[model samples]
Target chain A: MALLEVKDLKVRVEEREILHGLTLTVNEGEIHAIMGPNGSGKSTLSHVIAGKPGYEVTDGQILFKGEDLLEMAPEERAAKGVFLAFQYPVEIPGVTTMNFLRTALNAQRKARGESELMVPDFLKKVREVSKSLNIPQDMLKRGVNVGFSGGEKKRNEVLQMALFEPSLCILDEMDSGLDIDALRIAADGVNALHSPKRAMVVITHYQRLLNYIVPDVVHVMSKGRVVKSGGKELALELEESGYTQFEDAA
Target chain B: MNVAVAKTGSGRAVSDLFASAEGRLPGSPSVIASRREAFETYERLGLPHRRIEEWKYTDLRALVGEVLPLAAAPDAAALKRAADAVKAHAIAGARKLVLVDGVFAADLSDVRALTAEAGFRTLRETLEKDAGLLTTASTDAVIALNAAMATDGVVLSIADGAQLSAPIQIIHIATAASASAFTRSQVVIGKGARATLVESFVAAGAKAYQVNDAVIVTVGDDADVAHIRLMDDAPDAVNVTSHFVTVGANVKLNFFNMTTGAAVSRLQGLITLAGEGSELSANGVNLLQKTEHGDTTLVVDHAVPNCVSREVFRAVIDDRAHSVFQGRIIVRPDAQKTDGKMMTRALLLSDEAEADNKPELEIFADDVSCGHGATSGALDDSLLFYLKARGLPEKQAQALLIQAFVGEAVEQIADDGLREHVIGIAERWLERRS
Candidate 1:
């Protein structure tokens, strides 16, 4: 059985349909990279899977672990081990990053009927995860993503992904606005979270990010659906041929 | 010319109460005369209604209905209740000055210790000796009423160069329900003195009461002070507090107010930068729920050159509550190089909840930099979704966002413990909301 299965997923925003008949499947332990140009519905697919509000699912169904994924709230899906790294992380003033992480982690645990983590243990875990992501301890003390540099924000998202340890991870344009140094650092954090029991769907427009966190399979998305799917070499092929071909082919 | 206007029911009730209570009120002959003059002013102005520009949003005549009679002197049981309330609301390491039923409770206050550091006197005692203390230049009807009917309050005067090690907590506890309490207090900080003052208004088993309180604060040259007011009255109480503050040269005044309780309450501030080089950071938060209505109106007068002022007010309204903020900054004609900025924001949690934000600026100086902004909105959907995606439930997500919204203004408290205490109050409000 697939970890995530989207059957003819059609998502509409207001009067416009953004994801038209998009279908895909991800099995456990596989790292799939979905490469696409802007407005190709890569983000819309991630948002719909995460159950963001305002995107109406006009048709189709999503299954996770053989359960109806679309029927759950975003938090419920998150508790069931689904995570989406936001393309543009929000700046929530007055809530420290450390506090947000603990609240989120505990909420998920509580939802899964697990005991809450002790303060010392939670702090230790956050310190270890953040240190590896090159996030300074002071950054944790500051407001979540407030006044953070672009690279810092991306790294913060990766830090959450590492701590969450979700089964299915969807990274939507995580490499945007990141310098090469920051990109490599964020990619390393994501790579360190890879596990045989985990599945990841990395969405990006450029192949540069694929260099650090290589994928097992690559899918080309154009006109709201996948136009082609192949091995890791497919990313390089798209980089060489450009998305215009895939756009025309679709 | 005095225009003929009919007095409201509440206004007429207050006048009768004043006439009956005048003999027992503490004051000298001249003070009594001043009180009579003040009462005449109130008679002419009547209760402020929607027609008055400053009282546009808050119609005191309608909301107050009929004013309750003055609260009687605290008896033994009332004193015990007030003591329990002080214990519950006291700030650690601060000297407590407790006022029960609008009268200073010497037994409950740290009077001996406070007097050693500053000039301490009850308003009752001060008015008996000093007749001029009863006179007020304010023309507002509510303030005039306070001047006429005030029974007792604190008169604290910090000496020059006095650095107080602990804060002075003034706790006003109402021990009688279905009655009114009118008190006026004053605090004078001399040159180079540093202090923190906390004024808390709470009730001890009291409801459906009325509180008319006023505090006059004077910050001298080079003095640094932080004034924090927490208004947690009874659920059915009506509270009105007027703050008159004057800052001197090179002074740093951090003023913060949090309103969480009361059926209908208004916290109005008239702060003046009277000397050059003074800085004022005035911030407030209004957390109202149910049918509560809270209004925070401030007028910051820049009367000198080279002074700076910043006012940030945040309000979170839930259920059918209404919150209003009116911030006005005035730069005097001769006050050049005055830097003033004001921002007020409101977040509505329910469809029936309402918020009104008005930020006004009157600039007469050509070279001053003055700006004001106001915004009222619901919580951002994208922000909420972002939190939910991270595993917070809908209610918890909303609470976190609401906290963050008001936390911006609560952070203006210079002290960490006070900040935490204010945050705890906000958390409890959120808990009740959920």
Candidate 2:
């Protein structure tokens, strides 16, 4: 069975249709990169899957682990092991990174009928995870994403993704606004989280990020639909040839 | 030609209250004369209405339709209830000066310990000897009414160059229902003295009561003061508080006010920087729910040069609650090099909830750098979605965002314990909301 199956998904936001019959499928242990030109509806697909508000699902269905994913709330989708790494992580001025992580983790645990992590255990786990990501302890002490550099915000998102350990992860333009070093660090973090039990959808316009994460399959999106799907070589092919052909074909 | 002013029902009630309670009220002949003069001022002004610019957002004449009679002096049972109320609202490690039903409760306060450090006298005692305490030059109707009707309050004087070790908690507890309590207190921090003062309004076995409380604080030169006001009245109570503060040269003042429990309340702060090189950090938070109405109006006056003042106020309105914030920063012509910035933000949780934010700046000094901003908004969709996507339910996510919203202002509290205490109150409010 597929980990995530989107069958002819049509979505509209604010009376304008953004996703026109987009279809995709993901299996466990797979890393799929969705490459597209601007206005390809790549982000719309990710946000729709994550159950973000303001998007109306006009047609089709989303199945997660053989269950209707569209029927669940965003948090429910999260507790069911689905995560979306935001393209532009918001700056929450008063919520500390540590507090946010703890609240999110505990909330998910409780929703899954699991006991909450004790304070000491939670602290130890956070410290270990943050250290591996090279995040300073002081950064975690500060407000979530507030005053964080581009790299730090990306790293923080990756940290959340790692801690949540979802079954399906969606990275939305994670490589944008990052320099080479910062991109490498963020990509490394993503790469380290790959597991046979998890599936990932990496959405980006640039193939430069695929060089680090190394997707198993590449899908080219154009005009709200997947116009092409091929092996990993498709990413390098498109990067070299540009998205003009795909855009024209769609 | 003098036009006759017709008194509203509340105004007439208040006048009759003073007429009936005058004989029983405390103070000597001179004090009585001062009270009569203040009452005349109140008669002239009547209850402030919506037409008054300062009371534009809050109309006392309408909201306070009928004034309750003065609360009787607390009896033995009432005192017992007030004792329990103090335990609930008291900040740990702080010496308490308690007032029950508008009169000082020395037995419940740390009077002996506090007296050892500073001069401690009730307004009842001070008014007996000196009428000057009640003579405030201001024409504000509420202050004048308080001057006319105030029964008992603390009159504390910290000697020059004295440094108190523990924070002072002035706990006002109401123990009667359908009654009013008008109390006025003053604190004089001598030159170079350091103190932390916390004024809390709570209730024990009280409902539908009214509280009109005022406090005057004078910080001497080089003194450092942290004044925190927490109002958690009964669910159906009406509370009005006035803070008159004067900061002297080279003084540091951190002021914070949090209102969570009152059904209808207004906290007005008139802070004046009278001396040079003073810094004032004023922060406030109003967490209102249901049909509650909470307003915080502040006037920060920079009377001298080289003073810096910052005001941050946050209001979170839920259900049909209404929250208003009015902040004005005035820089006098001679107050050059003054840096004053004021920001007020309101978060409306429900469609029916209302928030009014008005920020004004009156600057006569060309060299002064002054700015004011006001913003009213609901929770950010993107921020909320981010939190929800991370596994927080909608309610939990909203709570987190609201906490973060008010946390900016609450963080200005200088002491860690006090800050946490304020946060705890906010958390409990959130819990009740959920």
Candidate 3:
């Protein structure tokens, strides 16, 4: 069975429909990329899967590990190993990064019916992961995402994903606002988290990010649904065609 | 439409009690005269009502219902109850000065632990000979009433250039039910001296009790003083406290007040920059729940040049509770080069909860930089969702955001230990609610 199965999903936000009859599937150990233009509902798909509020799934079924995914709360879905890296990370004042990460990790552990990680052990793991991401230890002491550069915010997202170790990872425009060097660093972090039992769905507007974290399959999404699905070479084909023909087809 | 103001009989009750307790209250010959004058003023003004602009949010006459009988001297049982209350709210590494039933408890308090440069005496003892120190420094009606009815408190004096190693804690415990306690205290810091003073008020099995308290502080030139007040009385207690402070030249004053208890409570601060180059930061937090009404009002005056003052306040209200913050800054014409800023924010946790924030600035000096802001809001839904998405349950997410909301103002504490201590108290408050 596939790790995630979406059957003809239709989502409405504020009484206005955004995702219309979209369906996709992801198996374990496979990396799938969804390429689309602006307002193509790519981010909406990621948010719906993560159980964000205000997005109603009108007619669809989302099955994760053969269980109904829509019925669980956002935090429950997180514990069930569904993670979505936000495109625009929020800055929360007065909440230190270290404190937020610890609370989140322990909460997830508790939801899974497991004992919480000890403080000393948690600190050791955090320090080890943050060092490789080039995030200063002092930054962890500061407020979460406060005074952080765009690159720093993206790197922090990767750090959280690594710590949570989600079974299904959805990266929504993670390459936006990152320079060449930062891009490589973030890609390396994602590559390190890749495992045979874990699946990833990468959604982006351009094919540039695919060069670093290459995917086995790429789907062309437009007008609220996927129009085409092919191998990695299909990304290069669309990059050369500039998505104009795809827009016409939609 | 016309509204008829009802003649409240409760206001007359307060005046009647003062008239009956006049000669019986403790005071010297001169102090007796002052008390008579203060009582006349209280009678003329009556209890402040919603008609008054300053007391619009907190109508003393209406909310107080009826005047509580004056608290009598504590007996052996009452004293034991107060001692137990003191032990529960004690702060670590501080010299304690306990007051039971509004009278200083000698057996419970110890001043010998204080440094040699400090001199301490009871206010009742000092009032026996000299009444000049008990003179009224504020024009507020409730404050004048406190001055007239105050029975016992502490008079602490620190010598010049003395830096006390430990903080001084004045613990006020109430053991009487359906009664009132009035206490007055004063602290005088000499030139270049340093000290930390903490005032905590708690109750032991008291219901519908009333407490009227006052504190007067004078910071000498180049001196540093930090004052912290924690008010956690009985659930149905009514508390009203006033602080009068004067900051001298190049002096540093840090004042923080936290109110987590009481059904009806109000804390008023009247401060003045009496000298140049002085800096003052006054911060407060009010955590209220269930039908409680909490008010924090401040009137800061920058009367000299080259002075700076910052005021930050936060309130977290739940269940039908109401929180009020009124901050006014006045920069005199001669007070040029003054930098004054004030911000007050409130977080409402329930549908029926209410928060009223009023921040006003009156600047007559063009060379000064002064501003004020007030905001009242519920928790940000996006922030809550963000935390929840990270795996925190709904309750834990809301608690985290509420802590961060109040943490902004609590972090203004200059002393590290006091800051952490205040944060710890705030967290426990959240824990209890959740």
Candidate 4:
């Protein structure tokens, strides 16, 4: 069975429908990329999976590890090993990255009946993880995402995912506003943290990020639903040809 | 509305209280005599009433028109226990200034670091001294009242350019039935010095207690002073704390009032940017419930050129609770190049909860940038739905969103430990409310 399975999902935001009918399955260790234009519901798909508020699942079911995932809470979903890298990470001032990360990690750990990580041990592990992502240790002491550059904020999200070590990580427009160097750095950070026990859903408008962290499956999403599924080469074809064809097809 | 009309009543109440408190002081006759005159004047003026335009929204008259006589404290043992309990809740590692039942508890407070030569003294000592230190009338009615009636408070002074590593916690605990307690604190930061102060008022097992508190702070050239108030008491409690701060050239001053108590709790700041290049930041976080009302008001004056002032206040009102914020930024004609910004935001969690915000920018200088805005709204269903989609319970998601909303103001606070403590308080409040 797949690690995450969504069968005939129908989601709505407000009275208007955003996701009419969507179905997908992600097996462990596979990286799937969803490419689409603006208003394609790509971000909505990622947000819904991560349990963001506003978008409602009106029908169908989402099963994660054989359990009904749609019924769980956001933090519960997080504790169950799902992480969402927000398209626009909210800036939470007064909460240092270190403190927030520690709280989130301990919350997840405690939910699983695990012992609390010692402050020193946790700090050491965080520092190590940040170093691998090329994020400055000084930034970790600052407020979460406050005054962070676009790329820095994106990298911070990946850093959080790495520290949390979730089973399924959703990246929402992780490549937007990233320069060439930052794109490589962020993609490398995600690639380094990838493991056989983890599955990832990457949402993007462009195919640039795929160059660094190539995906095993690619899907074309438009008007709130995925219309086509293919391999990595499909991304290059769409990138070179533009979304004119897929926009009509989807 | 004209705040000047209410000035008279506020002055009278202030004078009466000052005289009543100072009359009992055992001190040099000379200092006492002058204070006595001021007290007489304060009593004649009395606390301001709502009929007065300036005091309209506050309605201080209603809060204290009855003038509950200041009752003597309860048993000494109980008062001492309350002080000890307060000492435990103080900002960790910060110096403690404990006031039990309206009187300074010397044993519970740390006085070893204080010195008369350094301008640090208890209100008692200041009264006995020949020093001609007196308070002048201002727009703040509460200040006059506090100055006239304050029975006990603190005098904190940092030497020129001395940086204090730890925050200072002034703990006021009132454990009395049918009693009124008054607290006053005076703080002076010398040139280039830096310090953070936390004023905590916690009431324990008190029935119908009234606390009138006041704090006066002065920051010298290049000095930085941060004042944080953490108030957690029963809903029957009544508290009115006023802060008067004067900033010298190049000094930086911040006042943060976080209140979570009382049937009617009002905190106000009367700040004066007296010298060029001075800066002031005033912020407040008020979380209220039931028919509770919490008011955070300020009157900021830019008396000198190149002065800067920033004010941000956020409130979360649930049930039938109410939160009021009235901020006034006045830039004088000669105070050119002054930059002042004020923003007050409120989150109404319940339909019955109400918020009143009046932010004014009075600019007399052509080169000044001063503006104020106030916004009030309930939790957006859209934001809530986003969190719910992630599998969070509706209540928990609302809590997170509420925390995030207020966190905007909290992030500006510089102290890490205190920030976390306030966040913890927010979390606890949300859990109880939820």
Candidate 5:
């Protein structure tokens, strides 16, 4: 069975249909990249899939592990191993990165009937993950992304994906605002999460990020539906030929 | 309605009580005639109330309906015990001062250098010099109402350039009921000195109601003082709170008040940036449940130039509880570069909960950044759903989000111990409800 199965799913934001009868199925152990131009509803697809507020699933349905996805809340979706690395991560003030991450992790563990980790043990893991991301331990104590630079915000999002180790990760504009060094670190974070049992949907506008975490399937999302699905070579062809060809085809 | 006032024969007794409360002046312990003159000033200024624009939200008319009695001599044994408990149980980093019925307990308190010079005396000494202090006690209507009412208070002073390494805490315990207690305290953080005063007013268990009055604190030039008041009086207690603060040239003061107890509580703070380049930041967090009614009305007057003022208030009200936050930030015409920001956000924890947030900014100067905002609403279901979807139980998710919301204010507390203490209280409250 596919890890995620979307059958003719329709979604709306503020009564405006953003996802019109879209269908896509992803099996475990595969990395899929959804590439599209601006206003192609890429970000909206990710947010709606994560159950963000104000986005209504009007028709059809989404099945995660054969269970209805639309009925769940955003946090519940997260606990179910559906992670959305927001293109623009919300800055929640007065909430320390350490506190938020710990709460999120323990929450998932408790749901799976797992034993809670001690503070010291959790702190140790946090320190290790932070160091791997080149994030200082001090930043963990500061409010989440309050004073972070643009690149830092993207890196922070990647760090969360790595820490949670979600089963299905969706990267939204992960390459935007990243410097060359930051870009490598971000790609490395995603690459580390790659496994046969896990799946990822990398959403981006440019072919720049695809070079690092090459997707098994490259899907072009335009005007709400996935217009075309092709192998990795299609990304190169599109990069060289530009998306105008798809716009014409649509 | 008019709950505080009692009928005296046929006339309204409130005006009469305050006029006497007003006539009573500077607690003159001194026999000298000059001391009498200062008392005259107290008479002239009179006791302020809701009729006064600044005191509108806090209706003390009913609060001062009955005349309060002068505080009885403190329960010496109980005062000492409370003092010992604080010293041993507090955040080991706290410097404590014990006051029974508003009178400083020398044997129980730890105020260094105050005994040697600067002619600083205890509240007891202040009373001796100012005989009128006791007469006007709760009777001045404010303190006269408090003296006529409060049991005791603590007098404190921080010398020039002397920075206390720990938070100085004043502990006031009331042992009487029915009769009110008027407690008066004066705290002076001298020039260039940095200190923090934490006043905890916890009443000794009692059945009758108690009224508390206190006016203490003067921050000097270039001085920095962080004043925190945690009012956790008895549930049956009826409190009328008032505190006056004056900050000198280039001084910075951060004042916070948290009221988690009392039947009906009203707190008022009058802050003045008395000199140039001074700053005052006042923040309050009120968590009221049941039918509890709490009000925090404040005035931050920027009388000098190059000074800044910021005030933010947050509240979590549940059940039929009511809360009011009336804040006024005034930038006088000559007060330039006055950056004042005020925000009040509240969460209606239940359908019956009520909250009134009044944010006012009166800026007379053109070169000033003054803005104010007020917001009140129920918990955001999406945020709650987000947390619950994260696998947390419905109650746990709600609790976590609530904690984070309140944590926004608690994180600003500089002292980690105090910050943790506040979070612990919030966490406990959430746990109980969950």
Candidate 6:
């Protein structure tokens, strides 16, 4: 069986249908890039898959590892190895990054019936992962995402992704605000986490991000459904032609 | 109800209570006269109601109907209970002065240890010998009532250039089943002196109790002081506390108060920047649940030039609890270059939970800078979703956000140990809510 199977997924937000009868399948160790214009339901798809509030799945079946995904809460889905790197990362004041990271890691661990991680071990892992991302030691002591530059925010997201180590990772507009250096660093972090047992879905507006983190399969989404699917070259063709042809096809 | 009936009932009751205990009250001749004058003032003022601008949100006439009778002295059993209470609330590296059932419990306190190194005197003894402490320029009716009915308290003075190695704690524990306690304390910090003073009002296996407490402090030139008060009385307790502070030139003062366990509480603070280049940072946190009602009223007066004051307060209320914050900043005409800012935020966790925040700024100086802001809100949905998406359960996520909300104010504490101690109290409150 595939790692994730979405059969006729129909989702609505605020009484308006956003994802209309969409179906998709992803095998293990696969990277699926969904490229589309603004308001084409790309971010909505990721949010619904992550069980965000206010998005009602009117009719659908989202199976992850042969279990119903839509039946779980957001935290439950996270514990079951699903993660969504938000398009707009929230800035929570007064909550240090180290505290947030530890709480989240322990919560997921507890849900999986594992003992809580010791402080020393946890700090060691954080120091190692943060060093790779070039996240300064002082930033970890500051409030979560507070006063962070655009690049810092995106890099922090990547750091969380690395720490959580989710099996099914969804990066929503992860490259929107990053410079070339930050984009490369974030892509490196994402690339480092790719494994045979993991699956990823990278959602973006432009094709610039795909240059650093290559995708195996690229899908063109217009309106609320995937209009076309092709190899990685599809991103190149769409980048050259723009989304007009895909809009016309839809 | 008619205004006359409303005013005369409780007013007459208090007047009769004070008249009956006139000679029996402990004090010098001057102290006795001050108590009579204070009771007369209380009679004229009656219980502050909605008509009073300062007591608009907190109507004592409605919330607190009749004051309970004075609490009697604690016996051996009650002393034992207070001792246990002290142990539970003991802060590491602090001298403890425990008050059991309205009177000083020397056996339950660390009086000898504190007296050896610092200036310490029981308030009752000081009142007997000297009545100068009973005088004040301000005419606050509640303070008058405290002065008139105070049973006992502590008088502490730190010498010039003396840096205390640890904190000095004053713990007020009520052991009576259904009684009230009125206590007053005064602390003097001399020039170049530094110290930390902690006060806590908690009940020892009591119900339907009341506490009327007041503290007056004077900070000398170039002195530094940190004062923290934690009020965790019984769930059915009615608590009222007033603090008056005067800061001298180049003085640094940090004051913090947290209320979590009282059913009906009103904490009032009045601070004056009496000298140039003084800095006053005040903050408070209120964690209320069930049907509790908590109010905090603060006034920061920048009476001198080149003074800076910042006030931040946070309230987290759940169930049917209500929280009120009234903060006022006043800059006098000659107080140029004064900087004052006040902010109060409230987080309501339930539909019925209510928060009322009123921030006022009165700037008479053209060159001064002053601002005030108030906000009432629920947990940010986006923030909550972010936490939940990171694998925290709903309860844990909410608790983390609430802690962070109140943590901003608690961070104002300058001392590391005191900050963590307050945070620990906050964490326990959150645990109870969860």
Q: Judged by lDDT relative to the true structure, which candidate is superior, 3 or 5?
A: 3
> Of the pair 2 and 4, which is ahead by TM-score?
2
The sequence of per-residue lDDT tens digits that candidate 6 reaches over residues B133-234 is 766665666677777888789999999998988899999998998788888889999999999999988888989998988889999999989999999898
Worst 10-residue lDDT window for candidate 5 chain B reads: B1-10
Candidates' C-alpha lDDT: 0.91, 0.91, 0.88, 0.78, 0.72, 0.89
Error of 6 at B138 (Å): 4.1
| TM-score of chain A considered alone, across all candidate predictions | 0.98, 0.98, 0.98, 0.97, 0.96, 0.98
Q: lDDT by residue for model 6 over A100-208, one digit each (tens)?
A: 9999999999999999999999999999999999999999999999999988898898899888889999999999878899889889998999999898999999899
In candidate 2, position B423 carries an lDDT of: 90
Docking class of 6: high
Candidate 5, residues B1-434, lDDT tens digits: the string is: 22222332313443443344343323443422433343343333344456656556555544434444444555767576566555543555576666655556667666663344232455545654554434422223354344432224556667899877777777666666655555666777889998887877776654345656666578999998888887766666767677778889988788888777676787877787879888777888887877778888888888878888878788888888888898888889998888888888998989999998888788898898889999999877755654543455667766766676676566557788887766665665566452
Clashing pairs in 2: none
The superposed Cα distance between candidate 3 and the true structure at residue B40, in angstroms, equals 3.6
i-RMSD of all predictions: 0.6, 0.5, 0.6, 4.5, 3.2, 0.5
- Candidate 2 per-residue lDDT, tens place, B25-140, comes to 79998889889989888777877778889999998877876668888899999999999988898899898999998989988999988888888999999988977777665878
Q: Fill in the DockQ of model 5.
A: 0.27
lDDT of 3 at B257: 92
- Shares of reference contacts reproduced by the candidates, in order, are 0.81, 0.92, 0.70, 0.25, 0.40, 0.87
Docking class of 1: medium
Candidate 2: tens digits of C-alpha lDDT, residues A1-250: 5899999999999999988998899999999999999888999999999999889999999999999999999999999999999999999988999999999999999999999989999898888888888999999989999999999999999999888889999999999999999999999989899999999899998889998999999999999999999999999899899999988898
- In candidate 3 the C-alpha lDDT for residue B285 amounts to 94
After superposition, which runs of candidate 1 have C-alpha atoms over 4 Å from their true positions? A240-250, B1-4, B8-14
Candidate 3 C-alpha error for residue B308, in Å: 1.1
Name the docking class for model 2.
Answer: high
lDDT of 1: 0.91
Cα lDDT for residue B96, model 2?
Answer: 97
lDDT of 4 by residue, B1-434 (tens): 33344344454553344445555543477756655655455455456666766667668677656455564644677666786677557777777778877878777776665342244567767766752444645545555544545566788788888888778788888778667787677888889998888888887677677888877888889988888888876678888877778889998887778888888888877899998998788888899988888888789999999988888899999999988888899999999999999999999989999998988788888998888888999987655553433334567667767787787777678888889988877777787784
Worst 10 residues of 1 chain B by lDDT: B1-10
The model with the greatest DockQ is 2
* iRMSD of prediction 5: 3.2
